[model samples]
Target chain A: MKQDIREILAKLGGLPVSVDTISDSADLYTAGLSSFASVQLMLGLEDKFDIEIPDHLLNRRSFASIDAIAETVSAVRAGQEAA
Target chain B: MDMQISLLDRLFDSGLLIDTGVEGVYARSGTFEDVITAFEGLIDRFAGNTGAEVIRFPPGMNRAHFEGSGYMKNFPQLAGTVHSFCGCELDHQNLIKCMAEGSDWTEGQKASDIVLTPAACYPLYPIVARRGPLASGGALFNIQSYCFRHEPSNDPARMQLFRMREFVRLGRPEDVMAFRGEWMEKGKELMGSLEMPVEVDVANDPFFGRAGRLLKNNQRDQNLKFELLIPINSVANPTACMSFNYHQDHFGSTWGLKTADGETAHTACVGFGLERIALALFHHHGLDPKLWPASVRKALGH
Candidate 1:
């Protein structure tokens, strides 16, 4: 799971990089995440997981970090499975 | 090989256009250069003979300015951020945690609220009316400004921060229509010149919920907003680029902008959503903007 998170981090180029260095609690936007790169991350999330993200969940909270995003993806997957 | 809309979203069911749908990056970078390029060509073709003098505006504005202009009454929802100071000492980290953990601070209320401007035109009225006017001639301005809105959607197409490049003129009603008319014709030509697959249509602002349903009717009756929509993600629901608006003495009366004869100078403005256009162009051409047609590349000066 951490490996998956790492790979996702790698794909997010032009973020204040060095995926090997940062901890989970670090603030991404204040630490220099450009809004442009965030869209790339969103697209990658949609394509990689092969799941649709609803409009309601489209916000900074869900996209803040690997931990937050992974939780969101798992929750979405679980919801899909439940249905 | 899939060519159906998402039944889940009625608007999404039309078709998904990927290129245009994805140019979110370019749009936020800045929308003015393209708008200016398009406007210059359009004005030369359409407004050249109308004797439109170009005026530039001061960047940014103050809250008192808008209050004086009645912006708070009409558009409270869309006002931008204002800077404010707590006018008190910063609490220690422990104090912050204590408050967070449900401990109340001693004898404290929060600071005052200053405001940011939401519209590009909010500051124009006060400046125009400052000299206690009676100039016989009408005024025309080419303004590019940073505009802010607290919109519901965070779609790249709908952004918190965006740029607006506008052609605004204050004159008689007939003159305002003539400017809009000239831009209307040139709007079609400019879209074609860029080879964007688009249509010109009337649109209403996302005013709100059930009440918003009637926006289209009102917009049509008053001819408020128009857009050139190129499908993003091939979705038939279009994004608005050019918005033409006529403020029939609403702003003029609020600010007391008067002509030599002492009537409110009719105000009209043509607004270009800079980022939206960049998105349209990026999607219409390829994402690798460097590889777009030479003419398009030249048109964008890229």
Candidate 2:
């Protein structure tokens, strides 16, 4: 949700990048995020937060940017806690 | 089964499958006739040996047919309707008045809506429902269905008018799966015998939009569908030669189809793209049917 995080994610291209440059609201597609790269990003986020993404959540909206992606992750986590 | 039956004897000589060109809608170009003939022969031989009776359904289904079947709930985008203006009258005066009122009408007319059959199986359900349940065990229907879709892509593989040569088998859950599995194997075997290269893998229907994407993934995970893919021109993205699907009690429940013990019937179907297959063979091999390799020609009943 931080502006710095959005800037970092926006610059994160198709290739793996240092965590320092990652942002929360980056435009993944405009930032050169390929389909394969999105999968890679999913894996990285799973490792970072220890949250497993269900297969159904694999889509454009889930990978649009760091802020959107974080919102989904938070929602999933909150749902898990409530359950 | 390997009786070396004459091509004509197997099909066209009281052949089970028929060749139809609904206003050139379903016909192929530069090789459609020969392809239709070949598919007719192929399906006739296959269906005849497998105990299926050929049935060519009407051009379209009725409006209530889909409404009763919950088609509008499941797939409204693919549904099409028959429309006509019986009588009407309109003029510039009417147009001007409508424009001023922010309403427009060309004429006043009587219109009734009729649903065009989405898939070949839509109409079959009603017919079978009226039959008062299939005999004790199971039944297989041989259908060469003409179907239409709105978003017919220019990709020759996707056509507005295409023939879905379907083998609809209904019975218990196990029976439906077995039928689909058996035909999946048979399709591969047939393709192999014809010397055509093919691959069998999990397949999907052209479900529409966002929700459809989720449904398609669910279909894959449930193993409800499989496809026989053959390289039509490019080896990278192959055309789906055939699809074997098991609909577990979906249609049966909708139509109230039941077995002897009173449980809903399980249904499965294997679809062959007759014209698409023809295009593949013609594109790969040439237009001359006689010149095709012996095994290939015989497989297609050339």
Candidate 3:
């Protein structure tokens, strides 16, 4: 899941630095991920994961890092399975 | 809500504003114009010595530049584009016929090269970039323009077409942030002189749709925007009379604006909503400018 998140970030994050160099907990915004790019990243993640991220999770903390995004994805997938 | 509507009605009845048969659109009387002119003079008194370049743009800007600004991406709901009837003679006849039939004649109108200027400082970015890299001391501009937004309301403060006076600063991030900070204080002082109630609070633009929620959150979390609020329509939900924005290389990267050292420039702007302030004064003081407090009149030089 972490590698998938990184792959998505590499494709759509528009980060200045390489995703490989960034730790799972590294702040994506600090690495030059713009608000515009973050929205793009969210859409890309939704498409790749086939899970709809709710409006409540659409926040800075949810997309703050690769680890954070992975956790959000898992929560969304878990909510879908329980339903 | 009743009080808000009455205020609009009173302004129209007092001849301070002329009713234009459209909500949020009104023609100002001469007295209102005088007040605006006097307030503008006061603004100049505060900021004129900064040696900022003065540039005034028309209410409409180049469509291509507006597209590049990414305004549509964020607030597509509020953007207004200029469209013209570019049909041939045959199509013109059809358009006339459509109009005569009391149908929608505007369907054939094509998009023009212009879009209503959403904010005063928007047109300045591309122009400044064309001047090449900024000087070591950086650049400051005094800009004013009639701005447009699509939100129509009975609240007189929320005009569909209004004027914005802005001071834009471009330089390193620290310089830009400092500029915004200085204006935030100056804004408070100016309002203080008028003896008006004011509060400064972190704010965000009305970014559009679901994705926009993230953008709005990030903006607030970063403290990128602030507003000086004054009660005009309601005290509980006061209107934003002034806004200070720190773009932090958003415009710099978009416009290719550069600092002297060849780094991307950071930009910040402080904007004053002229009509909103005038309305706030009337709402807080009195409908009659003559009856306004002596200090308030003196502050505005009325």
Clashes of 1: 10
Ranking by lDDT: 3, 2, 1
| Residue-by-residue lDDT tens digits, candidate 1, B38-120 | 54455355445655545444445766676787555434576664543243445555456667888865334442344544666
lDDT of candidate model 2 versus the reference: 0.68
Residue B188 displacement (Å), model 1: 1.7
> How many clashing pairs per prediction, in order?
10, 11, 0
**TM per model?**
0.60, 0.68, 0.97
Please give the distance, in angstroms, between residue B174's alpha carbon in candidate 3 and its true position after superposition: 0.7
* Pairs that collide, model 3: none
Give the C-alpha miss distance for residue B216 in model 2, angstroms. Answer: 1.1
Docking level for model 3:
high
Off by over 4 Å in 3: A80-83
Collision pairs in model 1: B5-B13, B15-B234, B16-B233, B16-B234, B17-B233, B17-B234, B19-B283, B20-B283, B31-B274, B81-B116
Number of the top candidate by DockQ? Answer: 3
TM-score (chain A) of candidate 1?
A: 0.82
* Candidate 3 lDDT over residue span B85-150, tens digit each: 999999999999999999999999999999999999999999999999999979999999999999
Q: Model 2, range B1-302, lDDT digits (tens) per residue?
A: 12212221232233322324322243334445676677678766765577776788765777787789877654777766775555425455665677788884544433355666677777787788788878776888888777776654434555566777788988888888888988888888877776778999997676655444545665676688898998864577888978899888778978998877778898999988876777666556655666778878777766
In candidate 2, stretches whose alpha carbon ends up further than 4 angstroms from where it belongs are: A1-55, A58-83, B1-31, B89-113
